[model samples]
Target: MRKKRALAGSGAALALGLAAGYPCLWRHACLTWGATAVEVHREMPGDALLPTAPLVTTRAVTVGAGPAEIWPWLVQMGPGRGGAYTYDWIENLMGLDMHSADRILPEFQDLGLGDTMRLGRNGPVMEVAGLDSGHALVFRSQDGAWVWSFGLYPSRHGTRLVSRNRIQPPDPSPLYRLFSLYVMEPGSLVMERRMLLGIKQRAEEPIAGR
Candidate 1:
């Protein structure tokens, strides 16, 4: 029992030590998750939404459908609309008031420039900075510190959905910068990766199956 305990303790300590020293590796993997080198460096449609970006990350996924078929899912995403195609239970636990929808909602399809999207029922909101049906949708935080861009491209298999984020928080504190580097980047990886997979799953489901 003593030997086993010592081994477990050593393993945990090693993992923590690696995490502390592995911030760059972790950030790199998260920044380029599910993306090719070309895709990671690709200049997406809404890149112009923000000027002088301090940080940027790009991720992507392939869907077995056309851009048109996958567009409705993007159009209706929000806290109270069709949800973010992410972990609703986790968001709700944080009082974000989100729920994933299984089908396209017609009411939310007419999204336009400057439309507001809430992260929670009563939380931070993002504005529609850019939109092009079946092509791209971009959202910017109210403070203009963050911009999220989603783009769809024709691919050999079907379509490639790419998500890019450009961040330049205005006057960020040292603590905030450290927290973002250590916590936000990795945390976003878990949530956003699941979101991409979720959208791919939904877009690929047959209409009859759905």
Candidate 2:
């Protein structure tokens, strides 16, 4: 009886601890991960992709390659092409049907302004909004509600790949907005972090036959 009571007490304590710590965890995930204040505040070329003020997320990684080496991977990202370089199982569970590419495919590398990419069979998810070859690419949602941008800046060793996401959720009640913020903000961070790391790994890998 005593052992059972002790176990129950410990479980309750653990639950309380998690409940208390959740807000801090959520804030860290939403506001700052792999990003500095300077990177977050600096205006990126793709900022003009959206006209409205949005909840912005900025994350970055350093890759041991130049922008040119990294550009091909970004260009080929989508369903039925090079998949989003995140956890494919999780995306598949969400019905995204992602199959992340290991090698750059020549066919998918010619992306241009106004081109569309699908998330699944569910129609267009992102449209090329603006691009500067070997430097930056920005994609906006078909409805113009979200903007995701990738920018590569020359660093001392290689390149700094910065990703910025700006989101304007559809008009909803204040309560619903709050709920969406808590859910979507952290979710985006998790997926985007995986994507950044995936791109970094791919970019740093040696070129085949070279």
Candidate 3:
């Protein structure tokens, strides 16, 4: 009886804590997960594309490998190419046929400036707006309202893989923007956090014969 009461109290406290932190969870904390102050505020490669974007998120991870080791994984990311390195089931549920590859795909490695990566089977496409071999890659939506970039910087541990996104939302109404702050912000945290972890895991794997 005493243990049950203790557990119930603990649960209630947790619930109350979450409620109190909802605002921070919505955007403040979610937007900068795994990112240092410098990374969160620094200018990324594709910032000029959406200079005045209202919603911007900057996330980073320290991969135990060099940029060249992780560059292939980024090159092969998308719905059809090497998949987004995320929750494939959740993505596929939304009609995104994502099949994450376990190895580098030679065919998809030639992603170029004019290339477009379709979001899903019939989803809107994002065009490759910038690329700098093993250092940076940026993509933008056809309407020019969203920009996504990956910047690689060498670190003492290994490498700092930073992902930044800038978006000039299609609907800028107060309510809509607030809804994004609560819903979309947390959702992005879930997916993008997993993506950074996934890339880190793959990039740190040792070669078979080496």
The residue-level lDDT of candidate 3 at 169 comes to 79
Candidate 2 per-residue C-alpha lDDT over 54-137 given as tens digits, one digit per residue, 9 for 90 to 100: 577889888889999999999999888899999999989877878999889999988989998766676447889888999889
Task: Rank by lDDT, highest first.
Answer: 3, 1, 2
Highest lDDT: give the candidate number. 3
Task: Judge candidate 1 at residue 102 and give its lDDT.
Answer: 85
lDDT per residue for candidate 1 within 1-210, as digits (tens), equals 999999999999998887787665567887889998999888887788785798888999999999988999998988888898889998889887779998889999999999997676565579998889899999998877889999999999999999999989555899888888877788788889999999999998964376
Give TM-scores for every candidate, taking all chains together and pairing residue i with residue i: 0.89, 0.85, 0.87
Best by TM-score: 1
lDDT of 2: 0.83
Error of 2 at 86 (Å): 0.8
The segments of candidate 2 whose C-alpha lies over 4 angstroms from its true place after superposition are: 1-29, 207-210
**Angstrom error at residue 4, model 2:** 5.8
Please give the range of 10 consecutive residues that has the lowest summed lDDT in model 2.
23-32
